[model samples]
Target chain A: MSAVMAESCLTRNEWICGEYLRTRSEELTDATVEHVTITLVAIALALLVAFPLALLARRWRLAAGPILSLTTVLYTVPSLAMYALLLPVFGISVSVVVCGLVLYSLTILVRNIMTGLDSVPDEAREAARGMGYGCARLLFGVELPLALPSLMAGVRIATVSAVSLTTVGAIVDHGGLGNLIYTGMDSYFKAQVLTASVLCVLLAIAADVLLLGAQRLLTPWTRAGRRAGRRRTAGIPRDSVMDAPGTVV
Target chain B: MGVLPDTWTWLTTAEHWSGDGGVWARLSEHLYLTGVCLALACAIALPLAMWLGHGGGRRFGGALAINISNAGRAVPTFAVLVLLSLGPLGDHGDLPTIVALVLFAVPPLLTNAYVGLSEADKDVVEAARGMGMSRRQLLARVEVPLAFPLIMTGVRTAAVQVVATATLAALAAGGGLGRIITAGFATYDTAQVVAGAVVVAVLALLVEGVLALAQRLFDPGHHRRRALAAAPATAVPARTAP
Candidate 1:
């Protein structure tokens, strides 16, 4: 298939079928996997840092402002410049790419985590405390669960941004789908470019859909509300269990 | 010891400021290119956003717009430049570069416009309708004015983004401040690169400041305040109905 595609690419002035197939089958799969892995690692690192910082920020408002502002400044620094600055210190390796990616993720992740923590209803915390729940137990059992949806939304945004920005890594001789894009540009191969572009879009959409589904699954109470509403409108007898608003604890 | 040629030499040289390759001449071309691209983006995105915001259609279209914008945000400016240059439009002067920048500029403009128009006070829109204003009139007279501030935020963002991204036009052999950056990169001239980066950043800041002023000036609430303060002094009845 690769040989055939190479032949067709040579013969055709426009993008050829075999070349498209070969590029997608041979080059794209490995590159996309690598990109996805790198992005996921970066997001994981961001979450590790951001979640604790968010908890700290919640405890200390003054700290949150400066930290968030610093992240915002980092966000404005252009992607290429960030990569260029890092290259000298970290070299053109996955470490530098990950550093840039993690730094970029901080702005989104911190905002998301802080908002999630702030949004946890005060009444829920009071009820949990009334039930004699400890801080660690309350946070894990109540607050984090309640804030999961918002936190996931932030993760969704961060993940998509990471996926896109990782393409800049291609400039530093790193291998990824961005390599295909850069190659297509350098060689003026439209099919290669379009195929890679389409793949990136698809990857973003797929990731979003999966995250959304996970959010829905983790927050069954929201779904339960819709179901209960439907049952009430249909004149079904509401069970006392369903009638009671579940306490956070 | 020096990075490259002196900055003043490049700036003051008459030959460098003349004809096709002159610095001033190139700057003018860059401005024209940037202006045309931004105008085209705003023109296309503004109406689309207004219509979408007005709830003329299902949100599926809005979702599509959001997705496309996200994609646009994801793709690096240089990557887009290269793709456009190679596809259909090859490195042929300003057209491809403009197209790329327009793509870059459109998303934020469209998203903000749609959000702003849609979020305008429903009561005000209803009042405008009660006054027997047509849909077009309501949009033109009420919605657009009210939404202008938020729309300007999008425009401000797009301006900064376009100006910064426009520097990539140099990669396509299109003349712009990017030419200096790319040239500097090629010749290993750190000063030239720094100069280009400085000028582009300054231009971005200036554009941002102008847009910020425009936002402040067009804020409907600001006008309302002035009107309230001036009301007692004027003999004419203030028109505050709708």
Candidate 2:
């Protein structure tokens, strides 16, 4: 059975080597879209869980160690093992992929978010409390903005890795570039595999750059010094306060 | 409960532990792939990173090399494996899988080593130099020992990741515990898949635990307080903005 499959795949080498993408533009586009959707959804879901968890850890200092270690354990579970663990429960689909990717993102996301919040000036927090700002208002109006760079750094790491990780979901028939990769591997279709793999890599790089752009746009004070100069009075004496958050996590 | 008993049954079966695709075979294959890939990555990345860290003149160049290598993380190991197996590397044996895993391991190895050496205490380095030490002596006697903890942390991180990711070798027709999962999937055996996953997870944790112990035993600067501070950051690729 394996020999026959390899032989059949070998037969497609001519067109696969020459005009693979042109011949299969539709498949490529669909896979690309699926890849993007999986990545975006996973990061979004990770953020939703990570934000509150990070805040909880911040509010209760003792909770930080256990929570971070739990996420680290989650992060350490290999991606393939993670998928298998999820598959029995979630069934073979996008949910399994998303759940696993979100789990992987949590360690970085929570750590960065916590770090960001930790870097908030104690004086600033006291001032916010003195001004009668509630917890929610203080978090959103002051703490979150100051925390933007670290949070965005985490988001960038999560987003880029999630893009690459989406390819692993092909086993569960999630219909992404991974599908093309696995199919190409099974059938030995060189062009199909190369195209899909390259696109997966490119997608990860592109997602990273896009997130960097979003970070720059959202945190304009990092780029514009006047706003930074103003914030310096109320900010923690940290060096990265004025820099872009593109630091690799 | 159903899955656990079924997984135990699958694991306990003598046949499952023998043959070309048996548990023992797959476990050894997984280890071989991880061992070779990690060795190659260390060979290639360690010297280069050490040189860059020790030289310290072209800080920009060293940072660039580290960053470019780290970008390797963004490229999924699976994609790289598929590309190599189906493309120029040829869909043959474990060559492509080795190449892909090695590439995946390099970034962390390179980054941590570079950061560890370059970030060594300036006072210590200056004192070494003042004591009539050559550059090599300083690196060998002072900097490398000082930097050992972070360097080993990088190795631990890479080893665990490689062990986990090398499971993909089975997808590319290479050998590993992943074959069990892949074969299980082929046969529609969820129990087998669950068992395979359990084995892989256990293997990963075991390797991680062993490395953690090895690090503590060999680390020159193994203060409990510093270890506590460094543990979380080292566990992940923490390039938090300084």
Candidate 3:
């Protein structure tokens, strides 16, 4: 589209141009940083909030119905709607994006947390009781460790989703790569749009793979149990529960 | 509270419901885009995934197809829509958006269809085969029926996601209810933005509820599942959150 067409891919506005990277290195780096920061912060906040909510649901069965339903309904709200719903209170800030993500993450995080807690075999609790371990010790030492795989799996799903969702934040002027992608699309900046999008995807995959490795490292016994060939997955944490209703919206 | 009353007024105003950017037009656009993408996705994914699930899963081609579909889910819909609209397909109105959305919607259907059939009862499949049923007959009479519930679930999930993403896609030169919200933003019409969001949310939930009803009504073993759910001996205590 430009007069300097003979220069190279940059002049040609090619989608796969490498010059976009050379010219926009700092810009890409800044967006990537913001994206990663928001994603990690949202997930951490969600985990902090969801664990107690899950425990509350477990401890008080009466509250379980309402707590679970509320989150599920929240999940059903589209992210765009969720953000728009939140913007009134947060006043068009990054908090709106983060809060929206945390709310969205709750349905999965809370459900998975409860599932992990529920899956702790009664016999293990009994054995811990037999050992004279106190309630706190029992929860932290036995229960949480046993539930690590499920909890980690939930975090993995939540993180990947958060990365995808952070792109939607661009509408609010904070969506890391999303900002680049949207602006690029406006002027038909092919290289910028493609590069930013590819970067966004790579970010999600990287987050997922990182979490998977962390799950393995933390739940070593899952691997050990599998290796020992004891009942073929009875003792192992099934992080393979990919039945997560991946609303990539 | 400030935004709420204005939003109510915005929604209540008949003028807001009939114009170019009105709720009716944007909504019809949203639904039209959603329906077309869903139909295309199902057309491309269901039969292939089902076939792979029935008799081809162990082969490399089948696995490759399944993996590719699953991998497609990781690409953000916003990015896809933007790039697609800006690409060679730019001049074709709604074509780029439809292509992006259809690509977006396929993965869930494929995975669900394939997984559902693969999970068909091996014992029941064998019994059907022993009764001298041909492979095609066994897949049709046994496997497909068994997997019907899950396939329906896949459809529900996909529809809901498409609706939500379509709303966002409108921000990046795409169309739908999202356009109303984006337009509201452009004009600093807070009430319109909030009202538009409310309508989109309601639409998403409506689609979800209707599909869930369909899943329940159309499932082949819906009665059996209901019976089992009612049976005390086999009944589980707590609900499994999706």
Candidate 4:
């Protein structure tokens, strides 16, 4: 509270204080690492669960409605509600947040994965079958590769969303930078609040750019001039990702 | 006490339904905040995006606006909520929550509204122009009407999100059903928290359903054909260079 200290934005608790960033770099880094870890794990988990579920929906046809409806319902659930609903099962661990994110993301992932599979040309599937390819071979070799663009699109949305939602995990004490944010909120620490939130946004945008790059690498045929097999045209535009309740259509 | 029956009892209790802290009070607060935020978002985003989409140097400027708004999606709702509440814009009260939610809601509105307007059947737009319709006439008579569904989709999307995240307003001393959840968290009352979650989820889904129904019922898609069921831009013969 000295005059000299008050002259600094950090001691004055002002936002945009570079001093806070310098002094709290370690804490910030740790929170960021935790945030990134939670996001990666949730996206990976959701993909694992979603592929089987998407296949089931595609296979049974009848199961498709219920699977989609359930995921959409899950998407509609507020993050707070979703977290609370899971706390009983996961019991105050980061898993509760991860579980909630995975469920929340299912709507987007399953829909995109389904769309990807459907976009695979019947001729390709028929040709694979004509060549004596079995169901697994057709799915693994022919359909999935063709479905890459859409699937990658789904992953990008789900990943961005997971990054954003991970902050809410702070309520339970595991929210990485979310912890700093909430603590800052409680204490009215302007620098912590502003810094943590900016980092979270930067993290989300960075994840999105990274995924877009990954999509390009994975599906090189989709490179600019070719534009042959990218099949994201059916539902709502994919341009608006993050926090969107996927294709309510 | 949060076992199924306990939550049932908690919901049924008169005490939980009728005070400043009651479900009814908080629900209204939540709804009021949601209503105001959605209206503000629509007012700001729809006009600006539509103008940009219609003609305002729509090629470069429109894309820039759309890209900027789309980038807006990367900003987390919670962070904005907390930042506004705790940062320079607000020290306390609903100002932060309102500002944050409006900002959170604008991007979808902008993206959808612009897409809806710009992507309105190009033929219909041209026909309207051919008929000597002024730009205003074409936009109002042809474009806005055509874009209604997508525009409303934006509204619905924004509304559901506001309902879901408005609960976070509780963190900022703003009133909303989120208070119910936070209060339960504060007290470690499992049943109360469970009840709050159930209500918020129901509200969000209900908003989504109602809006979907409205979009279906109200969209006057009179002259607009789905246009050869045009598959996305993928099939459109590449635009010949000017």
Candidate No. with top TM-score: 3
Candidate 4 residue pairs in clash (backbone atoms < 3 Å): A170-A175
Point to the candidate with the largest lDDT.
3
Chain B TM (all candidates): 0.83, 0.88, 0.91, 0.87
Instruction: Give fnat, all candidates.
Output: 0.15, 0.62, 0.61, 0.53
Model 3 lDDT per residue over B142-222, tens place: 999999987887798889888987898788777789988888877888888789889999999899899989888888898
Q: Report clash pairs, candidate 3.
A: none
- Evaluate residue B3 in candidate 2 and report its C-alpha lDDT on the 0 to 100 scale: 79
Model 1, position A52, has a per-residue lDDT of 86
TM-score versus the correct structure, for each prediction:
0.78, 0.87, 0.93, 0.89
Better of 3 and 4 by DockQ: 3
**Can you rank all candidates by lDDT, best first?**
3, 4, 2, 1
The Cα error of candidate 3 at residue A25, in Å, is: 0.9
Name the weakest run of 10 consecutive residues (lDDT summed) in model 2 chain A. Answer: A240-249
- RMSD after CA superposition, every candidate: 9.2, 6.6, 3.2, 5.5
| Superposed Cα deviation of residue A174, candidate 2 (Å) | 1.0
Ranking by TM-score: 3, 4, 2, 1
* Consecutive 10-residue window with the lowest summed lDDT within model 4 chain B: B222-231
Q: Which is better, 3 or 4, measured by TM-score?
A: 3
On the 0 to 100 scale, the lDDT of residue A48 in model 3 is 92
Q: Which stretches of candidate 3 lie over 4 Å from their true place?
A: A1-8, A228-243, B61-70, B228-242
Q: Docking quality tier of candidate 1?
A: incorrect
Residue B162 accuracy (lDDT) in model 1? 74
**Model 2 misplaced regions, further than 4 Å:** A1-18, A225-249, B56-60, B223-242
Lowest lDDT block of 10, candidate 1 chain B: B1-10
